[model samples]
Target: MTSSTDRVAIVTGGSGGIGRVSVERLARDGLAVVVHYAGNKDRADETVASVVDAGGRAIAVGGDVADEHRMGAVFDAAEQEFGGVDVLVHTAGIMPLSPIAQLDLDTFDRVQRTNVRGTFVVDQLAAKRMRAGGAIVNFSTSVTRLQIPGYGAYAASKGAVEALTLILARELRGRDITVNAVSPGPTATPLFFEGKTPEQIDGIAGANPMGRLGTPEDIAEMVSFLAGPARWVNGQVLYVNGGAA
Candidate 1:
């Protein structure tokens, strides 16, 4: 009964924000999803509930993207449950924004560990397990293009991600797989609006050409395209920022 159409997917950081939305969208698009979260089992369970409610297949799994052994188990679980992975979405990242002059080495290290190294780890694992025609989509930030103030450390980490993705695309050319990054502008997620008031969030949204902060669903739509039936769209960093950057 199974074919390439029933292949599995893993979305890292699926507990919240864009990750949660991506998981739901991929499930709706008909891929069996492994909802990978670092912590927050409650939120992860909520994500799974949403997917199953919509008549999709999903399971919540916990692992640190930057940890190899833990990620290995995540891969093993996906294979055991759904046969093998055909899509990998690396959305697990940390962004602590501060000017380099005020930034401590510890903050920079953490950002790199989660955003840069974490991406590399997940991509490598996906490549190992994915069949030809598979896709690995990573997350980057539009700040790398806009060079926004107070985002030096965070942008540097994503900048590394951009570079890694370009090389990865070429490295896996023979496999007929696609590796790409999706760079999103400011969106109205808890991560983006955590401490901001409603007015503050509105002001941020008003700056975009679309006159609104992006929803997680907006980003998830792009992920769905890259993961399924868009195999020709490979190794490219598609921006979903609504002309803000």
Candidate 2:
């Protein structure tokens, strides 16, 4: 069995806001980290630097999450670097909003490709290769339940993610590996603020009972818990939205 301090984690989208925080949090917990970025090596390097500077082990790897061969190389890197993979924090996804009526089929396909297909690609690799005591924390959205307008395509992709998480948990039965998804609501990431106005942001922040946006650190705490101490928390979608849903 890998010691807690020697466990390894691969955090996809680790160049982005929430992913970067999750990587640092996991590294702080003593797990060596592989920071997976799609195309942003600079940001990914920054993420890796944070961990390395803190005296933790980390490396940056870039490739499309939906590319099996490419992402497989990412897993290979982790195994080569840290002995084996124990935790997979899959936070790689994209969001582009448009009402169903005005939806571009091309955009919808792209969303499905990146969000849904990308998850399947990485999860498939993790399912087969991750150590027995490992965990897989895939990202979903509260919009699946919130059913907000203009989120049709994005929500659909995540909906598939939730479904996949449930079944994967069962399929990994007796493997000691846990599979789950984190459903965040209106987080204050650049992804969330992409096409909205100040009024819109304020409106969203006010909609939640907490009356504030969720920080990346807020979500990273949950990721840390799931990737480490959340052994029994399998096949669940933890909605970390500050009581918004």
Candidate 3:
């Protein structure tokens, strides 16, 4: 395993929500981090400032996750700034909720482009460029198992992420790299709170055995593990849902 001091990580969607927290968490773990944002430059700057204040090395880069050229630039920025990438936590994704029958084809396509294609693009770059003993973590959703009514398209996108994660792990045979996915349950990020009623949120939180909503920090901790010492734990989707299953 690579030592934290020598490791470099690129965290896509590192500007806000779970991605923001994951950047800080990995930085705290002693890895130099490249924080990737889609359009929110201000938020991305804030995340970088927080890491700097904490005495961790970090730089923010902007790009659309699904765009191959843009994401290649993200990887390029990491190598230029910190040498080479050793870990990639791909948290950049969208969650647009709509029933399958009512969901427009455009929305469905957008969801796939961002979530599924995004994972593939970044994972491909990481597979080719990341140093040996690297880790590639893709984000998935617990809703795939929950089968929530309005999550059809979103869940379908994450399902593809999970499949890619498993296949990529096997594809990287003899490379000593670990590929895995983190399936998070209802997390209390802006994404989850948006369009959610208080009663609905409460009901969902109560359904979990932990009786509380998962936090961005909770998911970050899992990513930190996978990005570091969890070498034997590859090609698996570790669900971090507080026993919500």
The whole-model lDDT of each prediction reads 0.88, 0.94, 0.95
Better of 2 and 3 by lDDT: 3
Best by lDDT: 3
Clash count, one per candidate? 0, 0, 0
TM-score of every candidate relative to the true structure:
0.95, 0.99, 0.99
Arrange candidates by TM-score, descending. Answer: 3, 2, 1
**How do the candidates rank by lDDT, highest first?**
3, 2, 1
User: Candidate 1 at 17: error in angstroms?
Assistant: 1.0
Q: Model 2, which residues run further than 4 Å from truth?
A: none
lDDT at 211, model 2: 97
Poorest 10 consecutive residues by lDDT, candidate 2: 1-10
lDDT (Cα) of model 3:
0.95
lDDT of 3 by residue, 1-245 (tens): 66899899999999999999999999999999999999999999999999999999999999999999999999999899999999999999999888899999999999999999999999999999999999999999999899999999999999999999999999999999999999999999999999999999999999999999999999999999999989899999999999987
Q: Report the lDDT tens digits of candidate 2 across residue range 148-181.
A: 9999999999999999999999999999999999
Per-residue lDDT tens digits of candidate 1, residues 115-139? 8889888888887888777889999
The predictions' CA RMSDs to the true structure, in order, are 1.7, 0.8, 0.6
